[model samples]
Target: MIKKLIILAIIVVIAVFIRNSPYSEYLTFSYLEENSDALLAYVSDNRYISIISYVFVYIVVAGLNLPGAAVMSLSGGFLFGAGFGTAFAVTGATLGACIGFLVSRYLLGDVLNTKYEKQLAKFNKELAVNGYLYMLTLRLIPIFPFFVINIVAGLTKLRLFTFFWTSFIGMLPGGFVYVYAGSRLSNIESPKDIFSPGMISAFILFGLLMLVPVVYKKVKGRV
Candidate 1:
């Protein structure tokens, strides 16, 4: 517990520093536009440094559940291009999310489980049966904050490995979409344009297409 608190404190300190730094300002698309060459040169001249810096930034972002993840995603695209940026961002984000998950579990899961065990027993049983599917679904749709998913999921009956793999795979498509769009930042007007009604409608159609099998099963069940 003491060790966890210490780690959490360290993470918090780093987050605060990053929040105030110039990188935080550069995280915006407009700032990135104004400083792309310098940013790219820094990344190229210090490849090792860039990787370490990305991991640190991701840890701070996910650890604190900060609002700048989208900006970070864009910065990744600007610095590393689409392919490498997607890989780096996903890997760093996942690792950081896992850390946050462990911290939350260690701190709160026991107390909540112990207090609500009796009332939650039935829900736990259901979770044990379908937790992996739900995790994948949440990863795809992103109804909850990434850090929240990490912490709250630890309280469920899902296996850790199952959660990890599902999250990793399920996050890929969305990651690709965002990173690809980020790679085209010069063409974009605003971050809000990324999820305009048309894009959302397209994603909704794609989601429905993917759900056909489950819908079939449900309809058959009713018959």
Candidate 2:
């Protein structure tokens, strides 16, 4: 309990520091737009360092459940182009999600399980049966908040490896889409501009496709 508390304290401190820090301003779309030229020049001059730094920052933002991931995704595309940007963003996001998941599991898993034994038990049972499909669907769908899924999955019996892989694969398409859009950042007025109704529908369609196997299995069993 002491250890958990200490860890929780550390997390809180980091989150507070980030929230209050002036550097937080750099996470905005306007900032990225304003400084695109300078930022691009820096990346061009220091390729390896830029990639490393970007990945680290991406991990921190996602792991901490901060608000800059979309901006960072756009920055990635703006700096690295779609192909490399998607790769780095997805890699960082998956790794960061794993960190969030571990933190949640370590801090609140036992307590939550004790408090909501029946509910968690039922959810875990469902996860044990189709955890991958469910996680994948959630990942592909943009409607669900990324951090919420990371935290909730921690409360379940889902394996770490399963969570990591599903998150990586599921986030790939969305990552690519965002990165691609970011490559055209000059034309974007707002982050909201990226997700038109058509784009959202496409994401939903992909998410639903992940459930096809489960639906097929259930129908076959019923027959």
- Which prediction has the highest TM-score against the true structure? 2
**Mind giving the per-residue lDDT tens digits that candidate 2 earns over 81-164?**
999999999999999999999998999787876887897777677677666887887888756699988988898878999999
How many clashes show up per model? 0, 0
Candidate 1, poorest ten consecutive residues by summed lDDT: 125-134
TM-score of 1: 0.79
Alpha-carbon TM-score of each model against the true structure: 0.79, 0.93
Native-referenced Cα lDDT, model 1 = 0.72
Alpha carbon lDDT at 154, candidate 1: 71
Off by over 4 Å in 2: 196-198
TM-score of 2: 0.93
lDDT of each: 0.72, 0.88
RMSD of each: 3.2, 1.7
